[model samples]
Target chain A: GESVGLHLPTLSVQEGDNSIINCAYSNSASDYFIWYKQESGKGPQFIIDIRSNMDKRQGQRVTVLLNKTVKHLSLQIAATQPGDSAVYFCAENGLKGGADGLTFGKGTHLIIQP
Target chain B: DAGITQSPRYKITETGRQVTLMCHQTWSHSYMFWYRQDLGHGLRLIYYSAAADITDKGEVPDGYVVSRSKTENFPLTLESATRSQTSVYFCASSSGGNNEQFFGPGTRLTVL
Candidate 1:
């Protein structure tokens, strides 16, 4: 079974528009969640993370929102740009520092339009 | 390099052959993990090690093997390559399972 999965396979947005990518996780015990961005020919790069204790965490132009009640997480990107075009993935780990590696979502491809 | 690196950015092998992919990190992180990515599927964990000689199986560990004899090196081997094994392999490390993982460039392997 898939522990995490994205709501959309691909998203196209115009430049300067705010973009939102959604993910659903089934692990009720999951405490830590992270979003990663991967460019062509590269591995996933860390974007932002949120713990179960918080509902939202904001980074530079990026915000992660966690809804434990619904078991959903979302990444909001402000002012989409060409450079922001990439695949976004959400990962979850129940133990903060345990050996249980993260389970990743299939991913959403974000395409920025001029 | 000061971060994690995977050797042979690309590889092609035949069925029933043995192949090993190498991973090395200079950060001396306490955790190392191997993941495989294929089209339409998320990266799946194959194996991981907390420290030297302390390895564990991940979500998709079948047909693959890993060893962590040293803190900085974790190698993944395929005992018998199959066409289904073709995918991009990534190696990642973190101070612990809780922290953010730093991933390598990845190795694209094709089993014929």
Candidate 2:
């Protein structure tokens, strides 16, 4: 099955610069998308989420852009900090019914270079 | 003290042995899910519970059993452990179908 995938496995960025992570999903039925950050030895923590009706959403220091036409999703971290170093994953909530589950991408490891 | 938690944080067992992983959440969320994380596979859902006494299979449910008698507890049991089952297991809970899910620290299981 053609599932959600990331263009890069690892992304390197300077401590004070901006960072962007890209994800591509094949399921056009996915109307909801979410970004999660998992630090070392920790579970995934929600970063931000966006709906198909909107093109962009912003959080404390993160922003998610959804391109429904291309089935592409991107997470932008402003003023990237060392704490932002972690594996970022994008999940699509397109499943129907009560037993449905989200489809996740392989994830992109974000490394903050000091 | 008030979030989702998984038991035995770490577990190791021999193949063919029965193993049960425990997941508990204090949020009292209506939805609970189990997922296994492997090298190539990011995260695959094992099972999910919509509410008390209601459960369903997810991406991979073979060789596994799940029971959700209570809303806050969802336990995953492996009838016969296998080396292929060695992976990081995570439990998550959500308020609703479209809500964001909160995951536990995860359980690293090793089936020798």
Candidate 3:
């Protein structure tokens, strides 16, 4: 009965501006969360991940923020570029002593304007 | 040089026909998953195999079946394809539970 959902379906940002995508989850038991980027024809690619113990994690040009109290997660991209345009997905992992499987969200389409 | 791969990148079949989508992983991961992506519905898990001969149904397992005869292969079959079955199928594998999954190029199926 756990689900991950995005706050927005589409986002548009200027080429040089920053972008923030938000996600909300309903499973408090989920301790692991991952962000994936999927291009038009390719499969989802791992972007960054964060565990419950930590509130934030940073990658090359992206940062993931987690708020356990509010059951919310977000991905931030600095200096957005045209190549960063893609569909972003948030997935949750709550094995709970069982085989770990991911529950994916509906995805947010990011459009970077050049 | 080893990763996940899916066969029949594109497929078109008539209703009531039987079709199978093949998935192979060279990582020899213990966990493999099958998912279908549709507009507005996102990616929904169909089935997953934790190991050889151990398979379990996922959120949208109806009208679909899966088998894991080996640790590196997990195939999904549609016994009787229907119009609603038209969607992009993706195969993913992870080294273990809760690990990052590596996905294959997906198979697009269109059932008429």
Q: What is the DockQ of each candidate?
A: 0.76, 0.69, 0.66
Per-residue lDDT of candidate 2, residues B1-112 (tens digit): 7799999899999999999999999989999999999989998989988999998888999999999988899999999999999999999999998879999999999999
- What local lDDT does model 3 show for residue B40? 88
State, as a TM-score between 0 and 1, how close model 3 is to the true structure. 0.97
**Reference-based lDDT, residue B84, model 3:** 98
Cα error, residue B55 of model 2, in Å, equals: 0.8
Clashing pairs in 3: none
lDDT for each residue of candidate 3 in B26-58, tens digit (9 for 90 to 100): 988999999899998999889888899999888
Ranking by DockQ: 1, 2, 3
State the displacement of the C-alpha of residue B106, model 3, in Å, after optimal TM-score superposition.
0.5
**What shift in Å separates residue A93 of candidate 2 from its native position after superposition?**
1.0
Pitting candidate 1 against candidate 2, the one with the higher DockQ is 1
Give the per-residue lDDT digits (tens) of candidate 1, residues A24-58.
Answer: 99888788999999999999999999988999999
Predicted complex 2: CAPRI docking category: medium
DockQ of 3: 0.66
User: Candidate 1's error at A77, in angstroms?
Assistant: 0.6
Q: For model 3 chain A, where is the 10-residue window of minimal lDDT?
A: A93-102
Instruction: Give chain A TM for each model in order.
Output: 0.95, 0.94, 0.95
Worst 10 residues of 2 chain B by lDDT: B48-57
Model 2, stretches more than 4 Å misplaced? A97-99
| Residue A22 shift from truth in candidate 3, angstroms | 0.4
Q: Write the per-residue lDDT of candidate 3 for residues A1-114, one digit (tens) a residue.
A: 668999999999999899999999999888889999999999999999998899999999999999999999999999999999999999998545225478889999999988
